[model samples]
Target: MISYLSASYIYPVTGPVLKNGVIGIDPDGLIRTVLSAEEAKNQNIELVTFYEGLLVPGFVNTHCHLELSHLKGKVEQHTGLTDFVQTVMKLRGADDSAIELAMLRADVEMLENGIVAVGDISNQAISSGIKRGSPIYYHTFLEVMGFNPATAKASINRALEFKQKFEGFPLSIVPHAPYSVSAELFEELRLVAEELPGPVSIHNQETPDENAFFERKEGGFLKLYEFLGLDIGFYEPSGKTSLQTVLPMMSDRQKTLLVHNTMSSNADVVFAKALHPLLYWCLCPNANLYIENKLPDVDMLRATGVKITLGTDSLASNTGLSIFAEMLCLQDNFDIPVEELIQWATANGAEFLGISDRYGSFETGKRPGINLLDFEEVNGRIVLGREMRRLY
Candidate 1:
């Protein structure tokens, strides 16, 4: 049996930090045993040290838009959410070959960043190249958008057909966003989600604009609709809004994932958590900042015992797809522990996608789809110091 030992901090999610820890991985990728360095040394185990870098599990990004990969720096000039929406829609029907290349490149970028999995959102039209064995494992959330009941049926049918193309374990049909989808369309997706066996993801409360549009038919989105010649009569502002209205409509078997709730308050988070503590919140900090220019109230969300995870939206709204960059953005704001942050991007991400049984943790019998990082030095000297360089 091949056993690998490492002296790095182990983040198993439910215990004290095992300082100077040694984790053994047998021939099977599953973790054979996790022991202290001294204990492993006493047993004559061969050790490969990762210096001071924590040997945490690979990151799990819970949301991203791979199809928008080609528009890396194209939409930045747009002023508000509505304007940005127009810009994306304008490019809606692009050449198939060009779009495919950017999508493939974006996929490769995420894999290189130590991301073993993702919760990706798609219009389902681009359902050709994305599959299980491609770069990183993905839970494809087929998105649909329509303003009237007439278009709703067609939208839902297309989404369902697209989702069926994936004859794999990690995939599902889900809404695109709360605002873009009309209540009629949302209800249709709800019925589809009800029959789905897996979890569902939605862009809820992503911005104050989305909340305003849904709750009052006012905000940047209203202006965008007026400019685009889309009618806004079906809009009925529910003075009260949250996933509560939407969740109950979906299948009980499927867990709901609320993405980009940057506008959700402490009370909003508390109520949602109490309703379903298992519900997950996907924070696209970089994407939020890039478009609407704000991140979520992470402290409030975490305090509510809600599950929170990170995502690198896509090249459209982000410079690149890197879980490390996303986690660093979190550190730039929240005073969270390194291990917990690691869990948010790794185990928690995998669990949300319902693929935790395989790739999340580094244990025996699991696929070692593990990724190692290579640090870039500024001047032939490590910034963190040579003693604290390599990390598993």
Candidate 2:
């Protein structure tokens, strides 16, 4: 049986908005076709489930840390990246039962928020069971971080072991962040990524200190290293931003997703675009404001013609895992068009994770779960309401 759903507006993500659009879906949730009300009327289609709001493809969260869900509200907000990292290190450990429960709740939350797919980061295999059983699609990133050059091989080996635990799931080995990975480890991970099947993700330029540390070896990261009791005697200043310093170590053959460009300049974006053929920039606006009390230069990034996606970092640094909320944040701050924001929240993320064929847009044969947004228009702008729900 085919179910027909119609709404005030339909955003397919890859195409123009359809007013009073009707979407035909198979019983298995695969999209069969999209047509206008006039087209449907011409075809003698009588039965339709009509909705009063906008309909869009379900959200794809490009970056998240499902393992850190237990840390929600435990850390203070607006503490800056260095202090935020220190706090997370101290409060991240908990009992197995507690961690599992938190992961389960976070998964449910994301689903209820109309998220159909996620690119989650995992340092351990603890969340494997939950992800395996989840209705929402998940691509786990086995995150490894080691600042000591001598332990580079050990770190990648450990990451590989964790990857084994997620055998049937879509996953890849990736670096945690620039501040926590050594040059040797970056090279080792690059080699692994070259052979890997998915895009690699890294936390990039989340703070000015990240650039300062690489350029002059002076910044809050210096204190971060001291707090971890790691010596960097052999490391030298690269005299460039962290993104510039690390982009060369990565493989241009493989796609790379750089998360949190809070301090990334226009030059950094240009350099990254020129050097890497396949590059994606992920924005976590709520988490950025929570940790650093700032947001990225959205105009600079957009102007550079870089592919941009959205993420809900983690419950540790955010109040909730809602892509709708992230979109509103960007809209409120940057006044980005709703159509463009929808692309970042849906198609762009699915493209980055290599799942565009199955998800992303509302194209025929794709099962990009349906989402309804009960929004209001004010002064020629979309004022998103809080009543977003999954309709599929």
TM-score per candidate, chains pooled: 0.88, 0.98
lDDT of 1 by residue, 122-166 (tens): 885574565544856778787787765578899888877776677
Query: 151, model 1: CA deviation in Å?
Result: 2.0
For residue 79, model 2's alpha carbon misses the true position, in angstroms, by 0.6
Task: Report the CA-based lDDT of candidate 2 relative to the real structure.
Answer: 0.92
Please provide, for model 2 over 1-392, each residue's C-alpha lDDT reduced to its tens digit, 9 standing for 90 to 100.
Answer: 99999998999888778889899999988999998878988987768999988899999999999999999999999999999999999999999999999999999999999999999999999999999999999999899999899999999999988888999999999988887888999999878876785888999999989999999999998898899999989889899999999888888887789999999999998899889999999999999999999999999898888999999999999999999999989988996778888999999999999999989899999999999998888887666666788987
- Quote the lDDT for 38 in model 2: 89
